[model samples]
Target: MSTFFHIHHDGDAHGPEAQRIHTELIEPVMRDLEERGRLDRFYVLNFSGPRPFVRLIVEPRESHGSNLAREVLASLRSRARELDFLGEHDIQPQGKVA
Candidate 1:
């Protein structure tokens, strides 16, 4: 099984706080996961019109699964929460892909 973390950015995505989180929290974990072959995929989506928002999709390798990814994601979320940039987040189970 795979695991996906859905992150929603409530504030300005390009703002200083967001940048800090990206640089210090997100990017480092991403690099570590990539080097370990534990990163399945990552994507960013934007919603248009009023209340524009951005969404982050992160999938971790099936072998490592949610157990491992959750720890890293939780850290990232904690930082974001402290910065007040996080809207919400959720983890969903992803079936293995061929």
Candidate 2:
């Protein structure tokens, strides 16, 4: 199973802004976590709808336990706030999945 975190943004999913967010914001954080060996695998999905969103599917390192997902989510949220992006988006834990 894996845990998913949905980062709902109030903007176009396929816009340059979304690409910037992924490259400048999300990627850096995910890369850092990966370097720290905190996660087994992670994926980012861009979705367009009434409320466009970026979904993060994370598989935590078994040695790190389930809390790793929550930790990563918190880190992303914190980084977003630091980068002044949280005001336009929200990160929510979508729970576990098979």
Candidate 3:
């Protein structure tokens, strides 16, 4: 099954360490997804505020064997910890059949 995964986190999405994690951990996942033809687009978004908001959107090419939600959860979870994100995160999954 294919999936479109949306991840939400409270952190400094643009900070140096956050950027490192984004490039290293998160980008790799998106790479694998693209290679498998399961990735339409993957990207991180940031919000401006005292309480920062960060998110990654995963758009899959097909809805078969989709584990984007799980994968994204892991990425966000791990990176946030390593980066010591000032805020916690809430991961949300959204899917649509194509």
Candidate 4:
């Protein structure tokens, strides 16, 4: 199944910690998904405001297995918490509509 995952940050998206998390945690999992041919679509969007952050778009590959969502979420969540982002930030999946 495919879903939209959002990570809203209240801090600096280009900060040192954010960069580390992306490099160490998020990127690896994304690369895995790509290698598995289970990554359908991806994007990085930015919004400017008093609180600025980036939104990432990930679409599961059409022929993916049942566990693709779980795998992706697990990888992102682990690093988000490590960066102290679970509270001020948010990570949730938007179910794909049939």
Off by over 4 Å in 2: 96-98
Q: How accurate is candidate 3 locally (lDDT)?
A: 0.58
lDDT digits (tens) for residues 1-98 of candidate 1: 43444444444656654455456656766777778887777665444433434444566787776466565556666666665655434222233322
lDDT of 2 by residue, 15-97 (tens): 87678668877788878878998878888899999988888888878887557876777788788888887653487878552
Best by lDDT: 2
Model 1, residue 18: distance off in Å is 2.0
- lDDT for residue 43 in candidate 4, whole number 0-100: 65
Pairs of residues clashing in candidate 2: none
The predicted structure with the larger lDDT, 2 or 4, is: 2
Query: Best candidate per TM-score, number?
Result: 2
Candidate 4: misplaced stretches above 4 Å?
Answer: 13-21, 65-67, 82-89, 96-98
User: Could you tell me the lDDT of residue 26 within candidate 4?
Assistant: 62
Off by over 4 Å in 1: 1-11, 45-54, 77-98
lDDT score of residue 62 within candidate 3: 60
Q: Comparing candidate 1 with candidate 2, which one achieves the higher TM-score?
A: 2
Task: Please write out the lDDT profile of model 3 over residues 23-98, one tens digit for every residue.
Answer: 7657876787688776688767765566554456666666634565676566556665675653334444555422
Query: For each candidate, what TM-score against the reference?
Result: 0.51, 0.86, 0.56, 0.61
